[model samples]
Target chain A: MRMDRLRELREAKGLSREGLARVAGVSAKTIEAHEYGRTSDVSVSIAYRIAAALELPLDDLFSASLKAVTLKEAV
Target chain B: MRMDRLRELREAKGLSREGLARVAGVSAKTIEAHEYGRTSDVSVSIAYRIAAALELPLDDLFSASLKAVTLKEAV
Candidate 1:
């Protein structure tokens, strides 16, 4: 969310939000939430799952700002 | 779990099992289960939390074999 580029990343992989969510084991609502910036901070687990779905590193799935916040906070 | 290197990682991070568990928002039972190899596959969220607790990338907390299995499986 907030420039996380989730939508772009999913599109680049040629996956619909629902398709990605299926692979990531999360609800499409969650994917939509991230894509729309309704959920700005993503948990590392969720990020990791999404990254795995895309065959990317976890960092590549998140925006720098979200990364900073998530990393600074305790898991 | 099974060569996940979780114990080595916690030690390297200067964290006791309980300390790491605390930071990761998981129970020490889970950490002990992992360290003793009673558990072999880590869910991405748990892996992400442990990695975050140590300020490392998700891959750093996992062994190659475990990574292969986890990544290959559905999230």
Candidate 2:
């Protein structure tokens, strides 16, 4: 649910929150909620949209490598 | 929102739907709904959980290459 990298990436591109949200086809609130970790209900589809809009790989936006590893072990 | 790869990967791993759901920490219905495209509310987090459970990369599970490319151009 963390998106520090996303914030950095978006800012580096000189895009406002709403600017990216508009182009990504998601609500501004969705982008704000994700960047601020306001909720844990982030959808995979939206994340992919954001990543695509940013022209980066999806894995690059999350800081959850440890979590992915843990979940992998759980399976 | 397609997950044909997911169904195939799970079956190849010799896991029943419920079995994989148990291991992935998601409900069987979540797996079922996603597999059938019953809804488009697929969350990014759940998809990652499923992918982690399958021991496969997330990008491999989707058939939306064209969409991703489109979004990239939009931003």
Error of 1 at B29 (Å): 5.6
Model 1: how far residue B65 lies from native, Å: 1.9
In candidate 1, list every pair of residues with a backbone clash: none
Model 2, residue A48: distance off in Å is: 1.3
Angstrom error at residue B30, model 1: 5.7
Whole-model lDDT, model 1? 0.70
Error of 2 at B23 (Å): 1.4
Q: Which ten residues in a row have the lowest lDDT in candidate 2 chain B?
A: B66-75
Clashing pairs in 2: A43-B43, A43-B44, A44-B43, A44-B44
Best by DockQ: 2
How does residue A13 of candidate 2 score in lDDT? 86
| DockQ of every candidate structure | 0.27, 0.47
Number of backbone collisions per candidate, in order?
A: 0, 4
> Which stretches of model 1 miss by more than 4 angstroms?
A1-4, A19-30, A36-49, B1-3, B18-30, B36-49
